[model samples]
Target chain A: MITVSNLKKEYGTVQALKGISFSIAEGEFYGLLGPNGAGKTTTISIMSTILEPTAGEVNIAGYDLRTNPIECKKTIGVVPQEIALYNDMSAQDNLLFWGSLYGVSKGELIKRIDEILHLFGLHERKNDKVKTYSGGMKRRINIASALLHQPKVLFMDEPTVGIDPQSRNLIFEVVEKLHQSGMTIVYTTHYMEEAERFCNRIGVIDSGQIIAQGTLDELRKSSSIKETIAIAFANLTDELFQKISLAWPEVKRFDQTIHFFTSNSKNDLAKIILNSNELGLDIVNIEIMKVNLETIFLSLTGKQLRD
Target chain B: MFQLAFKDLKLFFTDRRAMLLTFLLPVTLITLFAFAFGGIGKAKNEVKEYDLPVCDLDLTEDSKTAIAALDTDKAVHVVMVTLEQAQEDVKKGNKDCVLIFHKGFADSLLYGSPLPVELQYDEAQEIQVSMLQRALFTTLAMVPYSNRNNAQRMLNKQFDKLIGGGNEQLKAQVHAQSDSLFKSVGKGVEANPKTSSSTKIAIGSDIKMTKLVEAKEENSPGLIQAVAGTAIMMLLFSVAAIGAGLLDEKQEGTLKKLLYSPMHPNNILFGKMITANSISILQLTVMFIYATVAFGLDIFSHVPSLVLMIVVTAYACSSFGVLLASFAKTRQQVQGFSTLIVLVMSCIGGSMIPIFIMPEFMQKIAVVSVNYWSIQGFYDIFWRTLPLTDTTFLTRILVLFVIGSSLNLVALRMFKKNILQIA
Candidate 1:
């Protein structure tokens, strides 16, 4: 178990973290959901031992971060938000380099590199430079480097930030597989759906504090809001959107002419239809959706997960 | 950490940028430098072959006088046993120039004018002919102002008017002074009439003069060692800036993976230092072998201690390069800073020029430069041949090692703190 009590960190005038606390257990796929500038990365960096906490008590796998940092670090793996790697070397070489750092012998490093390459379906292009690989291939290699040591806790900061759906699905599958295999994972990201599907528990952080924390279903059961409605409308006009925004004010985000949030779509449907008719707007599609991470984040923070 | 180092070593060779920055570029620069300073250290030691000719036709006093003048110059390299022999040999190209001082050279001088001797030479012997001409002019110019005919008549008139017959003592005294003036001109400037002559000859003085001449020639050979030493010194820095490889690692997230190991940051620093040091030493070793092969320098053979000194110097330079690279954010920045620092150190540290020749303030600055000690150590060992008994060589090596390792320690600490911050 990873336990933290009263974690506080500051960088000169900027108070990045103000007394935050959380915990993670083995086999738990925990997600940190927050908007930009939410201190998620800072927290993850400190937990990974890459950055030190100014004031905190973190016992990672029974090793204190302050006094037993080396031992604590040995139990963890980190996949940075940024692509930190040697671009000049091939994917196979980069993985081997990482494996060696953890004291893996040559034979073992070769074995791990081959296994990870096959597992990620990257064996064919293993010898190509990372810079030449597409965004997703590079991401796979980045995650593989973190997993080479097979640490007790794997901490990833925004693993699926920017990539195609195909690549995103691949990462989600591997992350789920690792969690199912009893590997503890601390995943931080701004994408609500990604977190909703993969995380066993999540913390919705805003402005350096955790506003809400629980399993996806538990957080979705926010006392303040219930249910949600998502609809895809063809040729949704600004006039209709303005009417909806002014009337409901809870349409968190609209993508491809569709708005989703934690608002009640049944009783509010009458008001939405009346406003749309007043504005003479046409509705092409509508659907009532189940409670999800998007609705939970919006209900708890009173703001969108990504502005 | 050792495993990380091995991987780094493997990856260093395969990584195009790292290989280019670390090995290829330094080798290129070393080749360029060797070519640029190509003729250095070579020009001074060349033993020029001078072809010379000598002609002596001396059956009379005047001919003997002229022959003595010709033989006076050490650089003349005279071959004068017979005029016919000189002409025949020079004509056959065995000599560079030949002289025929006319048979009446003494009578012409007595008649108050000198004869112009005939010189024969090839057009290709222009330099040799010119050298002889300069020497001839200098020797002839030292002859005392002569009015042989006028003075003789004046002397006869004096004898006719004053004494009617010669007074033996006065004639003897005049002859003595004239002979003194003659001997002075024939010998050297000491035959000068305007200067009083009181001379004593020290026995075996010419040997001392020969030694002094050799010493003067010794000072002119400084260029060879200076250019070579400085170029070799900067080569380490050019190689060590390969720390830019770290930036590549950081960008690819490989640095993150390396940092996840159970080892402390100090272990990583040691691995890097060893890598950098080994590369620098290898480069210097190759250059040393080249010098030995090309120049017959036997630099290693002459100075048994040079081997150890150069090793320490290379490590120091490369370690300092690591310290400079710790703060740079990118490969380009690391390269730029390394180049600037190496150039400044080489120029100011008496690598380009001798520190003793520079101004006092610059010399003081050189004391702080690692290259200064390195160059000094080399000079003390190689030039002076101080052997193993010299404490200076050992001290310089120790000091350089301490300075290098300390700087590397600081750089490693700085790297731990700031490497993560660069991105």
Candidate 2:
């Protein structure tokens, strides 16, 4: 469990975090979702004690981060966004080194390193230098190194960025398994689907403030935008697209697909089809989408998750 | 801390370029220096030989004796030639100087007149000119004084024998006549200004020219100096190379990962220092062993002093590297600053050149260079062959250790205050 209250961080004249507060209970998978430079990493950094807050307090597993940093650190593992590995060293060596730094005994560290390697599916290449590994393999080893100590809480910051799909799936499964095993995990990412799929509770942060924090359904109910009707058109002229936009004020165009935002999608879909037929445009495929994190983020920030 | 240091060493050893630079580069440089300086200190103290061209116009017994003296002198090689040839040789720079005895030089010496001589020399050859002047003076002094004294003694002995055989009255008359004749000759020689004194002056007895004992040819020339100089300089460079790993960790995000663990930032810095120190010692040890085996240097005779010097030097060099790393933000910045500091220290600290030969002001400035003190400590042990207990030697080693320790403390403070906080 982690508690971050009034967490504020300033880097010279720029404020990275501004009095954002949140807490995760034991065995909870909490996701901090935000766009780039939305203070997600800064929040995680302050809570993890990697970067000290300008004015705030963090408690990890009943230990205050400011007063008892070593105790707090001993209970947490951090997987940085970048590949923080000694390229010339083997995976086994990296694991052993990190384990020892956590004060694990020699025999236990060896056993833990083996288990972690196997868990990350990196046991086959454990003896090979990290520099010779592929991007996905390296990412796996990086995660494995963090898990060597078996800390109570794991903080993974954008771990799936730029990795192969298979590796990303493996990581997600590993994270899910760890959460099921009653471990507290704080995951920070911009991927809306990942947050929706893995996180038990999600915190939507923007511009150094947490705008929303709740479950998926709770977040959906809280947003003003409800559902989105997506229609794929085989042939839609510029005049027809303009006509559709004028007929429905909440409609937006994306390539060959036009999205119509409304509270009642079932009723809106019928009207859209009628208008399309009258305008001589063929509707190839139609989808009724519920309010998701992306829609909620777009409504709240007036921008996409990646922006 | 030890585990962290071990991990760092493992990484460095596996890096082939790092290993080569730490080990092979110093050995190669020392070998090149040994060959270039002709086996070390030998070149500076070599016995010098000068060539002297002699043109004796007098060609008398006295002039011949002077020429032979010039030839017999071990320092000079005398070449007999015509006056025209002698002048031409000196003018053409084929000879350092030409010694010419003018006509009547023998008469001038026999009559105790001024010795007529001309020394034609190349002005640019100052050392050779001074040597020739000294040799010429010695030769001229022997010729005039010995010949005149022998002539006077022989005449007196002949008069004594004549008086011993003849009657008393005849002996008395001969003695009176001889005394009167000698007195008149003495007055005449004194009244003649040119003959009053021989221009040839003997080197003063008080001057006491002591020849320096030749340096033993058995010791390898400049090898010890080369080893000491190269060791300190390369140690700084290699330690800096190792210290760059700190920046690497920072760039790769491993430093932040380490911070997330229970380990403190100071422990991280301490780990790096330990690794750098170990590698520095290893590098210097390799150099010493190679010097002893390849060049036959007697480095082991004073084992205690050598070990002390190595430890102190390694500590100072590694600490200096950490200090540089603390101030640098990037790997390139560390390289640039480390190189600038190491080269400046090497230049002033007697690594590239001996401190004894540097200008006095430069020598004073060299005190600020950590390399200067480290190399000087090595010199005390290796070159001077001083024992470790000697206060002068002990003080230098202690000062090096103290300075290194102090810098390390400051670097740790900086690491905690700036680098760790930034992360």
Candidate 3:
């Protein structure tokens, strides 16, 4: 439902968004994966019509972003990276206030607020000031506010940033449900797992340009490594890790979350996990996670997803 | 639009700080001003009662005339006493000032020339110096003309009947003979002289000082004009001050959320404009009540047109504040700009002082101030006692609306940034 052609934005001396092109079909969940300042937000701004592109064309639900901004804005919703909300106001008040801005009638707006609040598990906290809410509650409300207009297309920029794991998962579930209900989404984040689980197609952008784009499985099959294992634990000493890694030279600690990369996942993975505990290892969780976009992302970019 | 307007007002009114600033601050200050300066306006009319000392050094008929004359000059309440008694009364603080007549003071009056008399007074009363000095000069200027008849009457009398004829020629000769025979006639009688300058009072005349002061303010409406002008001025500024709350909203993330809604930004501005105008109208109403009720002036006789002008000026201030807010990065910045702009307008517009009394250049500066138009509207309403025709009021309303709308348009343009850029 969204098409962006040769989108480019300039800001004086800085080329904020280099020439880039992408599209998301109806009901598709697309990820514009990139680190901070990687042109993800600049691209989304063009698609959302909050900003104008120096040289490009974006059509949202068949309305051009430049020529028909109000019509284009009418078709989609945007949840920015920042928690843009009134802290002094109650959650329901904030929602109703924004709902009115969208020209939503009072009768319809009251009904819509009820459904949306219940959907986000914020029905009980409706009257409480947003300043008193926890980080996760605020993030959920932030995402829910973007969906107030029930736009056909939704643009979410780092929606899960600074949120707790539980709220992050809840938001992930909500977005999954949205996709199933035929709402096209443009999701941008540095979180590789979010991109892997939710996106129908992924675009890995870096330095204002899209470096790679395709399905996770399609890209993973072409990666240099065949399997990628992410091992998470608390207090696994560096000396112990070094000795275990020395026995298996392919094991490299990737800053807190160690990764085991190999072509033979069935045989090499067992010895790796077994020897990991042999030297004072406190293994909280061990899993042979399937290799997808994150692995391909690390392999192609030579950096962690959260760089 | 109504919903937005109501929402903005609801939020602002619920906020105790905003309410206190917009309503409480101005009202408190106005009350304090009344408490402090209320007496200043009517002080001119309050007659200060003071006892004036009259030292009778002469028991002659001339001394009696001077006493009656002192009574006629209403500025002083004459108290007759001997020289020693008057000095004692003045020393006891029972008298404000003292006038002394040396012995043989009537002889100088008979010559139709200057009289030698003395006026002893306190130095603490600076006000008495000017008033008494003017009363002295006025009394002296008429003395020459007054003494001609007295001198004529005295000279027409027999030589033995020296006191019968009130003539300057006979009294001059009798005074010379009395002086020569005083040592020969008696041993107990003594006349000790002091100064030789003339300072005397005679003949009763009326000068209503109380009436003079009442007519001054009645003719010059500076105090009323200043209060009305300042009220109109600060009323507009109170609207602007409340608009600073919108800037607070912008800084605190409320603007972002509000902007993200489907409503146009203009809708939000319109709502704010209404809230501002409504608050100012309420304040103006209260001040007008104080003017008419407390002070007993018909400050609100032309309420309809006054309210119209207030609404227009309120809109203008509100829009101007928003425009300034768009340029400010913080609440402090907004306050700085508001102070600068409001003070200039108040000064030039004759709010702090009366425009009629101000210099011409300042009045010229007032021509450019919205406060000037608002105050002029008030003058037309209260002072001139004009009617409620739409034509008389529309010029001020139109000027404010045009400037205010233009400012609001500029603010709207500033908010028209790319949504994604905010992220």
Q: Judged by lDDT, which candidate is best?
A: 2
> Candidate 3: which stretches are off by over 4 Å?
A229-290, B1-237, B265-271, B290-300, B388-399, B409-423
The list of candidate 2 runs beyond 4 A from truth reads A232-253, A267-285, B1-221, B417-422
Residues A88-147 of candidate 1: C-alpha lDDT, one tens digit per residue: 889998888777778778988898889889888899999999889888888888899888
Q: lDDT by residue for model 2 over B368-411, one digit each (tens)?
A: 88877877676556544456777768888888999899989998
lDDT of 1 by residue, B199-224 (tens): 21211100000010111212222533
Better of 1 and 2 by DockQ: 2
| Of 1 and 3, the candidate ranking higher by TM-score | 1
**Rank order (by DockQ, best first):** 2, 1, 3
TM-score of each: 0.68, 0.71, 0.63
Off by over 4 Å in 1: A124-132, A164-166, A230-246, A253-263, A279-285, B1-227, B300-304, B354-364, B419-423
Across A62-145, the per-residue lDDT of candidate 2 in tens digits comes to: 999999999988899899898988999999998888889889999999998888788889888899999999899899988888
Of the candidates numbered 1 and 3, which has the greater DockQ value? 1
Query: Can you give the lDDT of residue B62 in candidate 2?
Result: 76
* Candidate 2 chain B, poorest ten consecutive residues by summed lDDT: B205-214
DockQ for each numbered candidate: 0.37, 0.60, 0.24
Complex DockQ, candidate 1? 0.37
DockQ of 3: 0.24
